[model samples]
Target: MFDITVLGCSGGTLEVGTSAYLVKSSRVAYQEILERELTDEIVAVDCGSGLAKLCEIVYDELCGEGDSMATKSLSFYTKDQVSCLEKFTSRGIKRVGMQLDTQCESTPMQVAWKLNHMVKNYLLTHPHLDHCSGLVINSPSFGAHSGKRVHGLDSTCKALGENVFNNVIWPDLTASDKGSCLQLCSMEDHVPKAINSTYTVTPFKVKHGELTSSESYASTSFVISHRVLKRSILMFGDLEADDPDTPNEGLNWKIWQHVAPMIVDGSLRTVMIECSTPNVDANQPLYGHLTPATLFQELLRLRDMVRSLNGSETLEGLEVLITHIKHENAMIPDPREVILGELTELKTLHNLEVNFTILLPGQTYTVS
Candidate 1:
């Protein structure tokens, strides 16, 4: 149903695709659906602000960060960022950007507003500061600007907390026609992509490390199910793998029961999940990430689960790809190949027979 592409694995925003959504926090990866047929239907999830900070910090080492021109006249917020909203919105004929961030800077707020104020346009999924970060994407100086017919699934606003915008964290900027357009719905209150669709999308909360461990900040993971294609993908945005039973040891359980069932339910042919470290050695705490070996463990568990669920003696040959590898670790001469080799070793376990790949930005997978 969809051609899966990996933008960046380590959950930060890396400029490796035509349309980018950097999951900028502890959960590090982004995906792009590069179907030439769906150009007008582009969708982006979360864009991490942590990426802006990291980019600037490593800019000189990577030959300098921040667009010299975009930053020249733009008012400064965080060090490396430039206002991309105004520049983007003005050019917007018919394009949609879903920002899934905790905050929307002042400048982007003004620029993001679709130019036409009176038209009652609709928002597809839910709109959060992250889901609508483009408001400040071009960095329009915040003030009263244009508004569009903004729609959200029933209770989208409630999920965000009634006064999320008015609080200290968000821009809290709304157009004059906000209330009128907000009440509109597409029949059911759930996300359009969640129910009956060619390609299915399900959003649920998962724990991931919080570099910015503020109350205002939180992260969630999503599983994309392409029914006709018989495949599923779960990306934990800044996901942490801790289990309540193992409280002191925050494993960020990558293979939780809820997620596992979903993966198994699909007639999945290929799968990709985050493995944030090269080895546990990458970070001693290992609080919010999984090692390649652990990812392998999960796949083995899932393979068996699927077999039992179907009550079939045959296994559907699960192809699991380990992703969200950090750039510094990935640069270590043939890192992905090393990870792949390890996954191959795991295939020897009984009837597991899993195929795996370590993700590098801009990597693409075609599921037949």
Candidate 2:
């Protein structure tokens, strides 16, 4: 079974945190369960802001030190005061900064520095700050000695290079203090990129169309498969299918067509998708995000595609674990309920045994 930890699974809102998931494919032996060591190779899908909260939770669980970092946020640091913060930092946490922006901040560079021993491979779905800002700060903080790799689409990489890492808003972590700890790698759509001997990651374009010329963003979903475990997890970064009312369109259908083949082959075991709002009315549909209703529609399309690929095979044991639900708003009803309720309705309508799970922050799930 592959284990996935919900680091920070909120939507675009910083107050609610953002996306950052840790996946581990390795399993401990039955006899060694008690003494199981943490996985050496940790794959991060998206490390956005609000990740400091997850860091704090993990810190409390592991070190029991709740007094030092009572305040969350990593923006308190100003590039020049690394030495001062390191004084109070834990062992191996080479540096520290003042508190960051609590709503849209990541775990301090020191925290990441302390855990830099683990091989981290970050995969970016897009260049949105809520999706990749944390990675930008933390990955390169290990300085000249670090070796973190970030994978993204060509356009996504270009966006990061021009906007985030061009020594403008932030220093290019890929080239700071001699060399960068983070190495940016560009990925091609629909091509299987091998992470190691056991794991492979395939990227597919999603329908997060551009908003403005400056904010020309594109999204790429991922399919992660482990050869040894024989399990695959499909992650939809952020999506919205073409609107019958708009002139812009064409990413979601193509992605569906590419993934439907895998579903028929039974290679895709679990789907970790995002549902941002309850319905289209509550969402800014032009921005390319999904609501519960849109997500349901997407699933219907998926069902039809899978059926077209392979006659009438029951999609039993398929897991649809949802992520990236927006935070509760005073203006609208709670989206979590609406999303789960919609999924329940779909299960009843289809009479399928597919499992639907809601990923909450700090929760751990095993998807096989």
Candidate 3:
């Protein structure tokens, strides 16, 4: 089982909460959590929101702030699941039914710091500012002695090294020498790289859209699997539906084909993807993101692929955790609500049996 915490899930409009997820193995014992020995076991999928957001979450949980957004988002989890999450938060909060000292402030900061330290690796899908600003901002606090590694594709690593961490914008912390805190590692496509003893991620390249008329922007989707249980979850970065007019047209189809067998065999049932906007016009520019109509069409294609691989025609038991919805403005209705309504309509219209959930910051979800 995997415990995924939505540290942040906004596409670009929000400042504090914008596309970071902390993934931990549920196999770790409760005693280990109490002992605070989970260092190097936790991996963050992105770093758009990091230590500051984590601190905020810890403070809210400890002080009974009852942030309405968190409360509403967490309502999706059962009581038992929320109880398990309390144990995962801090040593002061034990298993279900234990009392926590809500008055203490230092304990919450300590817990937040410990949780931040547990993240030894970051598997980044791309280096967009909304996807990596937190990582860049929190580098100084990572401790020079800490051997933290940032993993990404060659283009992503190159972009970060040349543009973001070039000492002018931020400190040049991507060196491997003793003084540097971070080591930037480039990963190859389709190769499964072990992030920790418990988890391995296989990355597949996907086209994000055109950077220029001649150059296409690149993004990635990762299939993260538990080594022992063999269960996997597919997570995507910003992506658009394949357009025949683009240079990298049909690239998204490759990812669907690769994961169809895993879905059919029941080894993978959870997919965390992005739907950045509501239903837009056919000619509207997405700028490397998906609208509700485009997202549903891509999912329908996946369902067809699964049916061809196996005799099954339905995506039953599939959990689609939608991420990265852009908040355009207050003048318009909430994009999340609008997108959810459209997705529901599409699901009913096509009779696709998939469970869709909009990811929100400060929520914990367990996938088994």
Candidate 4:
């Protein structure tokens, strides 16, 4: 089973919290699948904001026995903020899939800095602030011996350099210590990179609105696989689908083709997608994101793709975790309820056996 921990899954700002997820492989020897021996290794997906709440959860798990006052200060976090980061001592986490930089309001950077010993690699989906701002704020700690490796597409790395790490807005972390500390690795699309002996990550391009000349935009969807665990998880960063009538609307459909075979074969265990807004509230043109309607359409297309590929195959037992839900807007009121209701209706109408999970801060689940 793969351990999936939801740190923060809210879209945009931290009204609810931003995107951060922790994934750990419960190591099962390939030869001992029947014997069920397990080892523990962890990798974080995204490190968005919401440090206080995340710390609260960890604190409860680690220091529940003691009075709250006694455990007030546990490293960088203070009494008012919250801290139980020491819980990570149970497992080793070396890599983060998307390197989300810390925000001013929270201490995500401090948390990362405190745990730099275990953090070695950061795989970035895009250079967007909500996704990568944490890395910028914690530059001092990442320099020198505590340096961390950052991996992303060439375009993504370029965007980060020109927009985020530029000295004007933020320090150029790459130039620090003569570039010895923070190692930036540029990745190519479709090429799988080994993240360790157990994990391999493959990046695929996805359509997320228009990229104008002035915009330094680059985003991707990722497929993370564990060879020994025989499990894979698909993660979609912020994205939008082309118009139905447009000839190029098949972006996700094509991706479904690449991923459907694994889902059908039961090798892909979890699929995490962002549902940023309600159908009526999504401004696809202004901000590239997914609404419930578009998301449902994509899921239907994926189902069809699987059926066409192999009629006997089904998505049964495959877990679909919806992440990055936008905070409740005045117009939408309760976005999560509305999205869940719509998804439930669609599932009932189509009789999909797949399990659905709505990711929230501090929630953890097992993906097998």
For every model shown, the clashing-pair count is 35, 4, 0, 8
Residue 118 lDDT in candidate 1: 18
lDDT of 2 by residue, 153-234 (tens): 9988888888988889778777646577677889999899986556689898776756775553578888887777667778
Better of 1 and 2 by TM-score: 2
The whole-model lDDT of each prediction reads: 0.38, 0.64, 0.77, 0.62
lDDT accuracy of residue 65 in candidate 4: 30
TM-score of candidate 3 versus the correct structure, residues matched by position: 0.87
- Model 1 regions more than 4 Å off: 12-42, 48-200, 209-218, 226-233, 242-266, 281-283, 310-316, 328-335, 349-351
Compare the candidates by lDDT and give the number of the best one.
Answer: 3
TM-score for each of the candidates: 0.50, 0.76, 0.87, 0.77
Q: Which residue pairs collide in model 2, if any?
A: 73-100, 74-100, 75-100, 76-99
For candidate 3, the per-residue lDDT at 343 reads: 89
For model 3, the stretches where C-alpha displacement exceeds 4 angstroms are: 29-31, 34-36, 66-106, 244-249
lDDT of 3 by residue, 1-368 (tens): 66677778889776768999987666763225435666555778888999888877776777776453455444433344332223223221111211224555467678677667777889899999989999999998888867788888999999999999998999888765647788888999988899777778888888788988888888888888887888888999888788745523487788888888998888887888999999888787888898878888788888988998887556886888889988776667567767878988898999888877777677667664
Against the hidden true structure, what lDDT does model 3 obtain?
0.77
In model 2, the number of clashes is: 4
Lowest-lDDT window of 10 residues in candidate 4? 88-97
